[model samples]
Structures are given as C-alpha cells and as structure tokens.
Target: MVEKVDLLIKNGYVVTMDKEGRLFKNGAVAVSGNRIVAVDKTSSIEQKYSAERVIDATGKIVMPGIVVSHCHTHGQASMGMPAEVEMENFYDELAKWWWPFLEDQLKKEDVYALAKYAITEIAKNGVTTVDDVMEAPKDLPGVLDAEGKAFLEVGMRGILAFEATERISKENGKLGIQENVNFIKKWNDKPDALLRGVMCVHTVFSCSPEMLKEVKELADKYNAWINLHVEESMYEVEYSKKHFGKLPFEHLRDIGFLGPNVLAAQCVNTSDKEIKILKEYDVKVSHNIQTNMVIGVGLAPVPKMIDEGITVSLGNDGFYLDMFETIRTVYITHKGVLKDQSVLPPKKVLEMATIDGARAVGLENDIGSLEVGKKADIIVVDLNEPVPLNNSNIYGNIVSFGMGKNVKYTIIDGKIVVENQKVLTVDEEKVRKEAYDATVRIWTRNGFL
Candidate 1:
C-alpha cells in the first residue's frame, strides 16, 4: 500500500545538510507537488512510495540548490565593457565607469533580456534562488516589474529590489524609495511567491541616515529582508570616521539601522569590534570573495565572522554567476590569508551556499536543505571523477571540481528547470540573441562602441 508521488529521485548520494550533517549513501527524495514528501534510503523510498517520475541519480551528488545571497543580475549585460580601462580604485571604478556607463546606460526595455539571460546562466549552474538589487536609477519606476517578468519567464526564485540611495538628487532618491515601496506593496503577503521583494540600499556612504531608518521602518512593516553593501571598501570606513566619528557599523547601530532583517554584503574592511556589532544585531554577512579581489578591495574576514558565530554566506556580487567559483574561492581564499588550511572547510563552504544562504534571505524553513516538507529545490551534480566519490570525500570533490557543466539536473519546486546543462524554462537561443542585442544597445549608449 505504498503512496504515489510526483517525482522520486533515487540511488544517489544525498547530502541532507541538516543539523546532524546527515548523508545517505544510496538515498532518494520523494516529491509530492512542490514539497518533499520523504528523504531516506532508496530502498526505503521504493517500499514507501511510487512516483510518476523517477530519476536514477547514479554516480551523481544530490543536494540542495545554491542560494545566492547577493547579486546584481542587471549588470550581466555590462560585462567586459570599457575593456581597455584600468580600474585604479573602488570609488572611481563605480563613480566613473560602473555607475555612469553601466547603471545609467541601462534602459527599462533591456531589463527582461539581461535578467533572463543572467538568471538562466545561474540556474543552469544549480542556483535555484537569488537575491538581486537592480541599479538602473535612470529607469526607476516600474522597472522592477520588468525584472519580475524575467523571473516569471525563467520560473526561478528571486528576491528583487532597486538599490535606493541619496547619492543622487533627493528627488531621485525619493523616486528610488517610492519604487522599493511599490515593489514591496505588491509582494506584501505572498510568503510563497516565486518572486518576492526586499528593500535595498546601496551603502552607508551613498544613503543618508534618515533614508536608512525610513527603509528599515517600511521593511519591518512588511517583515521583508533588507540588503545592502557594508564595508566592501576601505573608503566606507574612512567616510564614516570623517563624518560621524565612529566606525561604519557603529554609525549603523547609532542610527538604529542594524537589525536581524539586514543582509549585509562584503565586510571586507570591517574590524573585530564591527563583527561583534553585527552579531549583536544578528545581521548576516554575504561574502563576495572573488568580487573583492577583482575590484582590488581588501578581503573580508570571513574566517573571523564564522568563528564569532555570525551566519556568513556566499554571493557572487553579480560580477560573475558561477556558484562553483564562489564556493571554491571562499574555501581557498581564507585559508591562504589565514595560513591555516583548517579554516573554511569544504563542508562549511557548502553550508554557506545552501542553508546559510537560505537563512540570509529568511527562507531557511523553506528552500535551503533537502528535508521532509521543505521546498524541492535541488541539484544533481555529476563530477565525472574517475576515482571513488563517497560521502567522506564527496564534499571536497564537488567543491574542488564542480562547475556549471557538471550540473546535470537542477530541480526547483518539483519542476525540472535545467537538465543536461540546459535551461528548460526559457528559449536559450532566443535569450542569447536578445541579451546580445540589449548589451549592444547599452554599450552603444555608453560610447563603448
């Protein structure tokens, strides 16, 4: 008298990533609709339930889908623009090239293609959920809707917002504020929405204290997440001391801006005292290891943050969407800097990409792990290794060798969104062409042609 389910993934090494760090050597996950009905040994699942679809995950790794804690998918189209220019420092790069030539040049019409193309790329790499901040100040009103349409088209999960700030004119900043409110209003009560909204600010340097408090109030009203960059560069620390006579996180704390709702990205220039403040407020850190290096910013003290018991998660910062690289970089970079190979082990890095990430977006109960009654967001990775891939060595092998191409299947919400390294929700060829068209249109406007 076995029950029937929609999908049963069998005979794979299932990394549960639960509190006990469970691993089923020959595991199966039974899905009923969008929820996981059971997770146990394959033989147990075979006796307990029958499925409409069964995937034989032989020689593959079955785990929770990667959750990107921070992203700027809008910048996907601007990749490699101003190719000949050297970015000497963080502020100049953003002020001169990134903010002006890219965010300013991006038009409303280009949102869908860039978002779709970028989201699709991340999806195929086993990213089921992403928290994104759009920066198109030139087209603020209703532009987040365009991003929503792109997420809907791809059938992935997104927490969307326009990075609201007062760096521009106060009027434009008000527009940014209104845009976030509008988006949040639409997603007010939809807890299970495939596309959700978060309130975003660019940085403390870019946003006023009053503006920061305003966003916090609205975000609390909706119980929504608030994301922003903090201590991503040394300039922010210097700016705070010169203006407010305190460190940056202290400024946030004094203004009553530090809270559990905040997902702060890149604590690269933060001190140990700042880490304590972050822990006090229960703020989560989104580590952008590669982006910090590429932008010439200092490395985040992720090892210290983790050691201090703060929830540190991994993000691309939208410089690149490769989750494998993000995971690997965090694994190796900290060890090199600390000169301690024991720091940021593969297992911890795996948690940063999955459960810790879910915690960052406040979706830990839903999407982060492969547990019973959780959302069925999972990835089947085929490392294609010639050696043994057991539970003891699996975490290391995947972290060391995994790539987008190795992701043979990406299952999100009981639906197969990507299979055989191809995205199934949208037309790949069509997206490629439109994405290129949008990039060209943007580049032409930026005078990069």
Candidate 2:
C-alpha cells in the first residue's frame, strides 16, 4: 500500500542535522500536511509514499531551514540610518539616542510593515524560524498583534515578545509587560501554534529585580520561554558591579531567574564564572557575533561557553538579516579571536544555527532537524559553486560557499512559502516599499531625518 503525502522533495544531498548527523547523497523527504512523513534514500521514499507536489532537488542540498534565535524586526527599516560617525559610542548610539528616539517613535503600523519586510528577507535567506523581541513601548497594549501579522504574512514560525523594562517609567514598563501577556494569551495559549509568544526584559539595568521576577512568574504561569539581553554591553557589566555587587549572570542566579527556559541573548562581557553559572542553569545563549564586534563590545567567550557545556546559538541581530553571513562569521570569528582554527568548526557553527538555535528557543523537538514526526521546515540550496560537494566536504563546502540567494526553495510547515527564489506568501516588493515608507514616517516624526 502506498502512503500519500502532500509534498515530495527528492534527488538531493540531504543534511538531516540530526543528532547522528546523517547525510545522504541521494535523499528524499516526504511531507504530509505539516509534518515530515519520511526522510531516507530517494528510492525508499518514492516506493513507500506518493506525493501531490514534487520538487526535484537535483544538484542541490536539502536541509533544515535556518533558525534565528534573536532579532528586533522593528529595526529592519532603520538599517543604515543615523550616520555612524556622529555617535560617540555604542551607549550613546543605542541607549541615549537610538532606543529613546527610534523605538519610541515606532507606531503600530511601523511594526507590521518593518517586521514583514525583515521576515520576508530572512525567509528568502532560508530562515524558517525566529525569536524576535519587539521594543516599542509607545505602541503598547496591542502592538504585538502588529508584528504577529507580519509573521503571518511572511508565513514564518516565530516566538514574539515585547521587551518589558522600566528605563522610561514603571508605568511604561507595566504596559510593556501587559503587551507580552496579551500576546501570549491570544497566540500561545493553544497547542501547536505556528506563531507563539514569550516574555522578555530589555536588560539587567533596564528592569528592576522585582520586574525581572515578575516577568519570570508570567513565563512560568504560561509555561512559556523567557528571553533577554544579558551583559550585552560593558555598561551592563559595570552596572552589575556598581549596583548589585556581583556579575549580571550571578545576580540572575541569586535571584532564581536563570533557568532552562531563559534564553540569554548576548553575554559579550561575561567571565568564566558567569559561563559556569549559565551552564549550571542550562540557560541557552544567542550569539550575535557581527553586532558585538561592530558595536565595539568585547567578543563573547563563545569558545569558552561551548567548552563549559553551555549551548550557544547564532542570531543575526537584525544587522545583515542574513543567516549565511552569520554562520560563516561564527565559523571564522572565534578562530580569529582565539587564534585557533580547530575551535568552532563548520559543523559546530552550522549546528549553532540550526538544532542548537531551536533548543535556545525551546523548539528543538519540533522544527530543528529533518526527521520523521517533525515539522517540515526545510530549504533547498543550489550548489552553483565550482567546488565539488561530496560526503567528506559537504559541511565545509556549504558553510564556506552557501549563499541564501541561491536557495531555490524554502518550505515552511509543509507549505511552499518561497519557491524558485520568489516568495509566495506575500508580495515581496510591496512589503519592501511599505517598510521604506514606515521608516520614513518614524524618522520624520522623531525629527531624525
């Protein structure tokens, strides 16, 4: 008896990204509805199941789609804004100006338009999932719905949150948290939802100890994930020492805020002790290498974190919004920083982008790998490079040569969201235009233009 499925993708080099690290030179994946039904040799899948839609992936690499563990989609439209030379430093650029000027000026429609544009480009870049923190206190209450609409329009899986903090005022902080509460109740209360909600705080200094514990309680009540920036800047570390008399991670541990469900975004200034603390709590780290370096923040001890049994995952941080660039950077940056070529190999960095990323976002069991009974979030990479892609060098070659522009197909939840480099879920150009106009509105209103 033949088992029928919704989609069949065959005749490609399949990288399963499984724990066993299975790769097949001539592999196939069968999807029914939203789950993977079969992943094996092409002949085996072809014999056991027939599919309604077939995608021939000859001369391509079939693999799980990229997962971005952290990003601010609202920053999409602000790319290349506020000429960099004018700012004194990162603190002046972000805390004194950017957050105060940009984040507060964001309207509900700006969140929708910019998030749509960012997610669309990320999907085209073979990213199937994201954990996004939208920081718009002024557009609170129902602002999360705006970004949720963008995720829906792009047809990407995501964990959305509003960054709750008291940097402005305690009441604004309350509004920020209420947005996350509303979003979680509306979107994540149900089972097997494509779009979900999580709890977030801006940073250690931005939120008080009471606010942090309160956020944790809400996450626990909903059984949801908690995410936040952890020592992302030197300012945060200095603040911790001056105010709390301990490191930031240590303060979290002392306060019972470090847990498996907590996804720490950037530990750029963490020490060995802090890394051990994170390992003790099984807290996941989302590493945005490019932003850390570009902003003059010290490079994170990523190699040390990995060595200490902490899971470090890749996130673009809305900077190029390209995971291929992030994977390549993660693969090379640590080696350059530590001057050791053996650390953070291509396979490990790729895992940081895929399976480890899913784990960081608490979705490892569902969508990280290409396995039976898992969600069908996959991409077909076109091997147009001159180098030969074989079993021995497949991982190396993909990490070194794979470009998101060459991804021929991007399938999410067994649906063809992007096929042949053309997005099907929404009009790509229209959303791009919408994002441009929205940014203009924000800047003009804030008088930054």
Candidate 3:
C-alpha cells in the first residue's frame, strides 16, 4: 500500500538546493505535515503516495523559498522617506532618520499593523524567512512588548533581535540585554513557534566594547544567534583604524566577537586580512549587494571570499526585499567589479539565495531545499507569462528573468501562505493602507516630510 501525503505539488520542475545541486524535470513533491516526504517522477509519486491536497504546478518553476539573513524590518514603515540633503554617514542615516522614527513616531498599534503589512509584502515576494533586527527604544518597555506581540501575531518564521546601540545612556545597554534575555526565555522551547531570539549589536562602530561584550555574553547564556553588522562602509573601516588602531574585522577578532554563531551582515570594506580572520573564526557573511551599490560603498570581495571556503548569503538591507534583484545584483556586480565575466555564475548565485541563506539564519537543516525530511517551504513560479521555452538553461534563465509576479504560490511549513499572488494571512489592502499611514506619521515625526 502507498503512503499518504497531506499535500503534493505535481508536474513541475523541481529545483533542489542540495549539495549536488539537483534539478528534476516533470517532478512531484509530496509533503506530509510540514516535511517533504518524496521527490520523484510525477507519475511515480502519484502511484506511491495519495495526496490530500494537490496543486497543479504545470509550466512553473518550483524552488526553495527566499530566506533573508539580515534586515532592519523595524524600519519598514520609513522605507521611502525623502533623502536628507545633509546626510554624511551611515550613523547619520540611522540617528537622524531610522532611530528617531522608531523612538518618537512608531505607535504601539502600528507595530502589529506594519508587521503584518511587511510580512504580507515579503511573502508575496516569496520570502518565507526573515531575520528582523527590530529597533528597540532607549527608555521604553512597551516598544519591545509590542514587537514581540507583532511577531506572534504574524506567525512567520523569523529571527528577532534587539537593535542595540550606545547612542543613548549606558543604562539602555543593560535594558537591551535584559529585553533579549526575557524574550528568549518566553519563547525558548516552543515547538510551533518559528521565531528565534538573536543578539543584534547594530555594528562595531556604533557599539562600545562594553556593549558588545554584554550582548555577546547574554547571547551565549541563552544559546541564541549573534547578528551584527561589520565593515559595511569605508567610514566604519576608517573609524576603527582611527579609534582602535586596527581594522574593524581585526578589532572584532581581537575582542573575540566573531564566531560560528555570529552572522556578520555586511563586509563591503573588508580587507584580505579581515576575510582571513572571518574564515578562521567561522563567521557567516550576509552580502547586501543592493544596499552597497545604492550607498556607493565599495563592492564586497564575494568571489574571493567564496573561494576561501566562506559562506556568503544574499540580503537586501533596509530597502527592497526582493531576492530576485539581490540574486541579479550578485551576478552582475561581481562580474563587473572584478572585470571578470565568470565571477558569480547563476548556479552559485542561486545557492547564495537558497541554501547559503538558510545556513546564515541557522535553519539549513529544515528548509532552503526541495529535499525529503526538509520543511516544504517552496515557491512555484509561472513560466507561461514570458513564454517561448528555454528548457536547456532554464535554471539560469529563471534567475535572470524571474520576478515576484512569476511566483504563483508560496508554501511555508506545509501551509500555503500565498496563492495566485495573493497573501493568505492578512488583508492586503488594509496592510498597505497601514504601511502608508505609518510612513507618513514617521516622516512627520522625524521632520522629514
């Protein structure tokens, strides 16, 4: 007798982000509960497992859902504010814009409404997982509470960390650490909770040595992931040189901050010595190609870092959350920056979005691939729109030509979160309205409007 399946995605091209990088034509993926149980020939899977729910993915590319490693989603409401005329550095950008918006204008009710809005938009873009470094208030307990409630209400897979910075009094540092610990304790071992606690020290330049050590120790005590920004710009690199007499990465290494448990968001200004130290310390890199190019920061040495056996995942920073653009940026930027055409191939770029991204968030074993025993987190892209089949190099073509509109469905943890380009969780129109309203309020409060 054949085994039963809860859901089956039938007759699609399955892209498996496995060690061998497998792609199966006319494939069928069977899911039992949250885990994928089989990937085989369509006819064979139908013969073996009876599906309770079936999705006809004909002429669509079924692949792993996008995983965003690091992002300031706490500022999702303030995304499109007009650029200030006198913006000088990243610190200025955060302090003048993002920080004040979070501290002053962001209402308690707005957290849930905006979170739902952000998650809806993100899911529509086929992003199933995100590591949201939330902006915590310097003197407010309610802000942290509101953020936790927002995460719980959305019911999405995410890593939430407090955005710790010493821009305020040193007492806020202790409060930030306590907030992380309290949140971790509350949701420590919940089976169905997809939210994980993380330690986020904004960046090396913004954090004092005491602040960095405190958060690191707290993270270790709770066994949570340490997410930090490093070498994101030339200014940060220069600041470290001026202040600590060492490069930023070296300063982190000397202070014993870089580790396997840490996810360094950006290293746009990293030196060869920094990359070597990163490899030695087993730190993961989250490459935000779009953000780097937008800010005119120097491009990361991605090809060299990958060749050195370092894992580099794709991220969008604070702007666009689309992985397709991120993947394209990785491919185009590296080739152009290196003056070498063979820098980041399509297959490798795809890996960075899928498997490598999963590894960055510490969930590679669960999702990130169409493999048995993995969670059925997948997206089906409609290929019929931009017709004229190119099956010969379809994988490469999908990366080059595919957009979020092509995503016909987004499945997360065995549940279809999006179908036919519509979000299943929240009211789309309401969320969009809330996002717009929040944006206006944030701008007015920050005097940006």
Ten contiguous residues minimizing lDDT sum, candidate 1: 80-89
Q: Which of the two, 2 or 3, has more TM-score?
A: 2
Per-residue lDDT of 92-124 in model 3, one digit per residue for the tens? Answer: 766676676564466666665666677777788
Q: Candidate 2, overall lDDT?
A: 0.88
Q: In order, what is each prediction's RMSD in angstroms?
A: 1.2, 1.3, 2.1
Candidate 3 has what TM-score?
A: 0.94
**lDDT scores of the candidates, listed in order:** 0.88, 0.88, 0.78
**Which lDDT tens digits does candidate 1 get at residues 278-379?**
999999999988889977888998888898899998889776788998898888888888899999889999999999999998899999999999999999
- Taking the tens digit of each residue's C-alpha lDDT, what string does model 2 give over 142-170? 88898888898789998998988898899
Which 10 consecutive residues of model 2 have the lowest summed lDDT? Answer: 82-91
| Residue 186 shift from truth in candidate 2, angstroms | 1.4
